[model samples]
Target: MRGSLGRRELLKGTAGSVALGLTTGARGSVSAAPEAERRRAVVIGSGFGGSITASRLARAGVPVLVLERGIRWPTGPNAETFPHMFSPDRRASWLTPRPVLTGSPPTVWRPYTGVLERVRGVGMDILCGSGVGGGSLVYHGMTIQPSAEHFTRSMPAGLDYERFDRDYYRRVESVLRPNGIPDDLLHAPEYRAVKQFHDHVAREGMAPYRVPLPIDWDFARRELRGEMKPSYTTGDVLYGVNNGGKRTVDVTYLAEAEATGRVEVATLHLVRDIARDSSGRWVVRADHITTDGTVRERKRIVTDALFLGAGSAGTTRLLVKAREKELIPDLPEAVGSNWGNNGDRIFSWTPLGDSPGALQGGPACMGVRDWDNPDGPVTVVHGPVPFPVDLGTTSVIGFGIVRPRGEFRYDPHRDDAVLHWSRSYDAELTDRIRERIRNIVGGSLADHLTNITLDTSAFDTTTFHPLGGATIGEVCDAHGRVLGQRGLYITDGALIPGSTGACNPSMTIAALAERNMDEIVAREVGKVF
Candidate 1:
């Protein structure tokens, strides 16, 4: 879409700034500074993980450059293509098209139609982000941590949970600022359904905890005080909200990091390949996509460190391609193996009467953790919402559980990833849970919660949470250091060991990134670029 700069323009413009700190050799080739002074890290994908990592690195005084494949929004030259789907003032962006599915045991993939089809196989909907903030700009902000029991049980034996909690998890929470919604506010109709579901579980002698969220309560309190209107409560968040609820990485970490002046984020620069120079420095090849439908491949950047925080699918595909091309051999066997979608299942029902606060735009504030059983199938029920309007008549109440039946592997022939997953439990088990939800919703407001089913067909279309692949273990030594690769690291959902029982994944991912960085900073490994 953009034109590649010729050698003449490159010598005096953007490339000149990059070449300032380097030495020019034969044939216009540039070499980086010595190891002692070269202290920059290149982060790909500016979603939750990448954004947070970049911010921390920059704050640490290590110059960090973020290369995002998507166009930057609001201020970038290509911002016009980056549309806000949920904006009340403007129509939605047609970039993300819905899919069409048929039959039982459905095949989950992008549908073959609309603009989404053009980039479908390239990890489109399941892992697509073509703007400044990445998915954080478009995801529903529901952030929850897994229970201690869930984390300990799923983690590999060698990982020290005590060390992990002390080193990484705590720092992550501080930056994310996750908080639990108050019980009283949750008594509203929508959350009442959530509480009722918990009540039913309690009646059955099962213990369920309220879901923790990442919303800014102080801001919400102001909105409730009439000082500010509930901006997020007005609509769905998957398409981006103006000034609403939870603190996305863009509004939080990235914004603050940019103020430091040490960090620079270049959007629309899609990284194509990573190679190591003769001197052991890292070189990145990128393609700058422009709005005019032209593709220009120029600008090779060399840095000392690199962080692969490009989600599971995106990061895994890049690594697999690199391995096949012999760019980086000796990658751990755990590069792209363990993968899980957190056993996502949406159960919908139509409430007979109108429900107040049902259309509120907050991401699920509370959930019934009643089914978080280690010995059996664990389930969590989310509050009802007007978004994703079910059957065109009824509101939808959704729930997801962590299932272990998930794996990620690379398909070199297809140049893509094969995500194989299934319901961790039988239909009968899920059906019983659905019935329990229906009964609870029915009893809570004197309205019937009808049309219940356990459908996997939805995965063929959309997902709010996706996890695993490049999981933690001896292969990476817990802190996400791939055994042999010296300067390479992974800090994304790909490092999640397994499914987080009855929990949303954004908080967990962000938390884990903080932890990984703690290890990196502790070792002083990323200090020299």
Candidate 2:
């Protein structure tokens, strides 16, 4: 069952606590302290990969500094930033107010293109969070490991996934503390809707699965106080979850990194470019935006170690910008190409008579994985809806399609990405998947059912799950080290050269970051200074 409090009410209830924790004396000391020693590694973009890198590096006794382009989003009354997507000014900015680009890359770039071609083109939303925690602040917090098939087929050679996953994936999961919904919550009426749909698929002989959420079990229990409120009931996570049900990097790795006193985060500071010095160290140029919106150019403290975790857009932009300026020459031909957003589509179903709750809240928890066949296109359902379950009045189910290798081109003329994605060649496969969904929903509800088809047109603008621009193998080597560049690394979604079949990208990104950092620590720690 849903909680007594409306979404707004839940925000009001949790706002005070988040504010007290996120914005207090925690960050004051860094701003007040004098310039510290130069044994530091400057990290660009504080999203999941960057945050995890900073934390792990700091724990290893390396002084780490994180530079973020967006302001430190506070979980205050203005936490209204969480639901800005449904706001009247939906088209005002490319992303939420906090500087996190939640929409997928292609969808976000579509308006700039002015041409919409569905066939032969794949549409993916590359959603990325900004601010101190990066995407962790806004992600659905679904922590999933990439399947073995992904590593064997998608990952580049020389990269051993067997060793990497065994050594580093667990560490990443431990830091994030992903949790599964209790059986009781899963059986709740809101969840039942999703389960019913899954059952229908199973009856039809499809492979369906449950979503693994990154919620801290104990913390969530305490917050609920024995009540039946869904964890996702308070804030709209697709924008940003201010009440902390989602375990963004700020609350996870970055927070722990800060406690060690070896890490510092500078929000609202955008990294423009990076260059290696004559001594082989790296110098990063950045633009720092003040609270009043003033932009000032600042040079980051020089370091021999640099990590770039600024999602696909930010990371690609920086690398491309740097290449254009000759900061690093002899760049690879594939530096800014082969990008893909998990081909995604949303489908909404209206259930019969007043369902227990609405669809306003609930982690994307159930899905079907029929996309694993090499002979056929793979498909996976993350989960079903739970709260705000009034199908006629308020509910919808969203499914993500993982599309492989669409082309990405950089347009220096427009200072934007020109992407061409198409699935026309796969029409038969696409139709088959669509039919599967139609049949399942039809079989489950019988008489009282209203189905809504959501093409790319339904949303005023589309959002993204992952975007890869400065992709791996093309832009950087196997270990995230950019080609023709020393002391620089790329460690975000941009490094994902292709899709991971049916899985969420966050845990995969985090695991890769951990693996990359381990390599850096083993080889470069003493050389940084």
Q: lDDT per prediction?
A: 0.53, 0.55
- For residues 201-290, what per-residue lDDT tens digits would candidate 2 score against the true structure? 677677666667777444334434544333454224555544455667776788898999988888756454555545676766554554
Q: Per-residue error at 403 for model 1, in Å?
A: 5.7
Query: What alpha-carbon RMSD in Å does predicted model 1 have with respect to the real structure?
Result: 8.6
Model 2: runs farther than 4 Å from truth?
1-39, 74-125, 190-192, 202-208, 217-231, 277-279, 351-357, 371-374, 377-379, 382-408, 413-432, 443-452, 456-463
lDDT score of residue 314 within candidate 1: 67
lDDT of 1 at 499: 59
Candidate 1 off by > 4 Å: 1-39, 71-130, 163-167, 182-210, 217-231, 291-293, 352-361, 371-374, 377-379, 387-414, 422-461, 526-529
The TM-scores of all predictions, comma-separated, are 0.73, 0.76
| 270-388: candidate 1 lDDT, tens digit per residue | 55555555566666655454432233435567777878887766676666545544556556656656665555555654443433234444555545554444334445555444333
Q: Compare the candidates by lDDT and give the number of the best one.
A: 2
